[model samples]
Target: MNGPGKIYNTINKCRICGADSIVDLINYGEQPLANSLKKHRDDVEQKIPLTLSFCKQSNHVQLKETVNKELLFSDYIWVTGTAASTKRFAKEFAQRVIQITNLQSHELVIEVASNDGTFLVPFKELGFSNVLGVDPAENLKTAALQNGIETITAFWNKNVSEEIIKKRGRAKVVMARNVLPHVSQIFDVVEGIRCALQDDGVAIIEFHNAGTILNELHYDSVYHEHLYYFSINSICYLFEKYSLYPFHADPSPISGGGYVLYLSATRKNKSKSLLQFMEQEESNKVNSHESWNRFAERCVEHKRLSREIIDKYYGRRVIGFGASARSSTYLNYCEFNSGNIEAVIDNNPMKQGQFTPGSSIPIISMEGGLRRKPDIIFILAWNFRHEIINLCRSKGYRGDFIVSFPFEPKVIQS
Candidate 1:
């Protein structure tokens, strides 16, 4: 899998267990990188097969192919501080971590994939001076530095972890939020987490829950960058392989819905909430093949229904709200383009002037979109539906809104 210029490779075995037990769950056909917004509408984009699969051996759900890490993350555009919701969550996350770990003010706290240092800022504000960030994006690292948070610009691996140990000693707290699923080298990253933490330190790993993905029909979250859709069982298997065991699990509001697992080198009694979470997953058969098959069927049906609803307003002015990565998957899967959508409105200025991948719809500022006098504002980022709707109304948008999720598309009168 190592090469100087290699782009991507198809996987025949499970990324976590290296077993020839991969089975296709859903194929999204050929799709572009979700975050690769184009500067020009006519610019040629690369499209690859984006399929989700399940590992019979490890019970891990992952993509059928691995896009090069550099290509996906090197010049990342997504930032954590852009959304108000994320900022609010950051404070809560910091408080929760401090309380759960009984973290000291002077102890080292390292966050992997710490985009723009938004999460780490709260720790520093809470009297923790030994906060650090590690991310692969140079541009984002610069942003983090400007925010007074020191960040190392490199991917998380055993070598990087060892270097950190030599420089600052092992961290008392290591948190990787929404990053475990994006790594193709699953074992390497987990080993890195094991090596980076102190023997008694808490390692918090947060990821999109595979159970929620199955039960909530959040197939729009499936993209090239996300290599694994991890179940709690699968994550425990990966961590326990390196002698790190989870003792607690709690729900996170990020990425629609997620789980934060607290692990340490020493084995400890599992929390009641963690046990309940696992039991519920087992009772619902979320990890079963039958559930996956049903989910795939629902995805197909949802796609059809979504397209049908959008087609009803084909000739009208339709602007998509929120140029999110998930929206990229949803819009491209629905075969939307400039003809179907006038322009996507996004708050992030980095994406406003760009065009969406595969779909080729221009991204615009909210004010620019409102100036167009659109008849319908399609809510593509349905996870923040209420917030987006309220923001639009506050900005004086009197148009109807459409939200697609949880089965079918619904239209709300202005």
Candidate 2:
């Protein structure tokens, strides 16, 4: 049960531009919460209508339905410290931010939705101890506090920003990583950012690029928590509404490929790279409704082909790899249960005894999963395909592998 009562709501108007009409790109049907894993296989899961949409007026993509924010994030299991890729990126990101902004050690820095303070530790490592982490998850806040990072257990809103400004003063550096899309109250959060940031301060916002999601066919990323899939134009519109101007943009390794945008209150000179990137978006027609319709067509085709490939190896001993949130979306979308996949291997110990939502596939430890010695290793965490493949090889599991992304979905042999 999703709490005691109703937990779903439908949004008719565009959250960004207040448009009355929007285009429905893809209907995923009823889907479970991507991160909500069940303790037992028989445990019932809540399913909600999952539909992706496009706002022609704002050129932004968002979900038609929204799950309650408290239910989705109050007590969370996903942590940034679980992945090596994220850890390495945190270090690199800190270095880049410091170099670009010349951030001083005395200046206050805050990170929104700072899971386990993975990104904040790097700033401290560079002699910047005046860092704060704000998040809604109690477990994650506790974890970040244990790491000696100051964290506030609260959702980021205009009120919270005003409180922070009153207590800690306005921040010189504010970083929001992968949190903008999850926010249903987009305007409230943007206003909070504006209130919390100094006029000259730089706010770093990193999000999954909508153009990449369309062109790459990363449909598995469409989950309830992610309310919006922002294109560069859409993000610019959102920020510019609050008098924030993006001056620079860079590529990020997160979610296959993402964008790290630097914004400030003052309209400084925009970087050449930022201009070129927006021009490329225009050239690619990334924000056009026709492109979205074509993407929907490709999604339908990818689903058919992927299911065909999965069925072809149905008779073999197939083991699933990486019980990630994205894996939940892919598995449930394909309707794969414990019958098709023996068990899912996850590095996170918290998920080891849990069953995946909707699909009911048991999650197990990496060692236990490898010991089964299956004929095929179906990698659901396709973004870390190379990393998972290397780890499996090092563990002496020489078996055939299957990857579901970059479309047409291929199988590689040992």
Candidate 3:
């Protein structure tokens, strides 16, 4: 049900439950595609409605409007290897899976949305011959292949899963990191997992936690690309339908504290730790309408505070650090264009010389931008606050370095 020129799609029913009963959350209004970097200054940015909604039946949180996959993928440039923290996490994550699952080299491990084959590369290094990566990004797939990572350049769906099973047999483990929300058909993804995995197989998925997003008022996390936000409740309800059960789960600090869930075809027993985590969520008011309403009020105030801070340093050369996807949402929401942000400094060369999707802020090399001696360095990629702040201080940029997250902008002392 798609065409080449299709711009977007709308979901009236709940993404997880397939129910007509749903509740409207906050509307961030029309937003440009977050990862749609501007190659030409004259190219027009595509805009779409960025509204969030919650389901009464399933307690799932998701975006009402979904940006087409073609716009975000195809020639995707966001690489996992580009981020230092993620690179470290990928190695550790691969090792952890090996230790817990006791995965043998002969058993296949398939990673969906494996950007630049970052995680799979570690598996290959560890002597895992049966490792494969599936992604829709052509440029990234090419890079992975050149680097000796075997990859299937396609989106992971039931058809793709069947194709993989026919070629390589069922996977012992299927992995998707920080990619669940970006998927439009939530059920298709989980169903594909069911089809692709062996009887004793496991599926590890990590997604942005709705509780953290609501409690911390991280409104900037919302964008057109992020189709669905998840909580433990939402994840369980969605997976259980396809006979996949979450036997274990933990919290992740990246992406504003995500939930790392380990699911399998068979549940050996009800995990006590998992039960306790669910209890914690219930006490945290994850399902209550009041909790989200409170979050909505805070989002309004946070936006006001961020604008005031930008206005305070009016006429000062304010360049942003970390031209990340998260930064795109925040910059656009706050209306920080070239007039406000001098230029965004990024470590990734792929992003350099390109403009941010909405703000149209030019992405430049970190060293080049720091040498310009901007008065204030606003850290949009606040997740790498420590690393970025240290880099700036080491370069002798005697200016205010601000971190925005967990609260308003706080100036990090030198």
Best by lDDT: 1
TM-score of 1: 0.98
* Candidate 1 lDDT trough over 10 residues, lowest sum: 1-10
How large is the C-alpha RMSD of every model relative to the true structure?
A: 1.4, 1.7, 1.9
Name the better of 2 and 3 by lDDT: 2
C-alpha lDDT of all candidate models, in order: 0.90, 0.89, 0.83
lDDT of 1 by residue, 139-254 (tens): 99999999999999999999999999999999999999999889988788888988998878999999999898888898888999899888888888888889999999989988
Worst 10 residues of 2 by lDDT: 1-10
- For 1-414, candidate 2 gives per-residue lDDT tens digits of 234466978878898899977879888878889899999999988899888998878777889888999989998889888888889999999999998888988989999999899999999999999999999999998899888899999999889989988989999999999999999888999889888988689989999999889889898989999999988999999999899999999999898888999999999898998998899899999989899999889988888887888898787778898888877777877778888888989999889999998999889998989888888999988888888999999999998999988666889988
Which tens-of-lDDT digit does each residue in 329-349 have in candidate 3? 788877889988899999999
**Which candidate would rank higher by TM-score, 1 or 3?**
1
lDDT score for candidate 3 against the true structure: 0.83
List, in order, the clash count of every candidate structure. Answer: 0, 0, 0
lDDT against true structure, model 1? 0.90
The TM-score values for the models, in the order shown, are 0.98, 0.97, 0.95
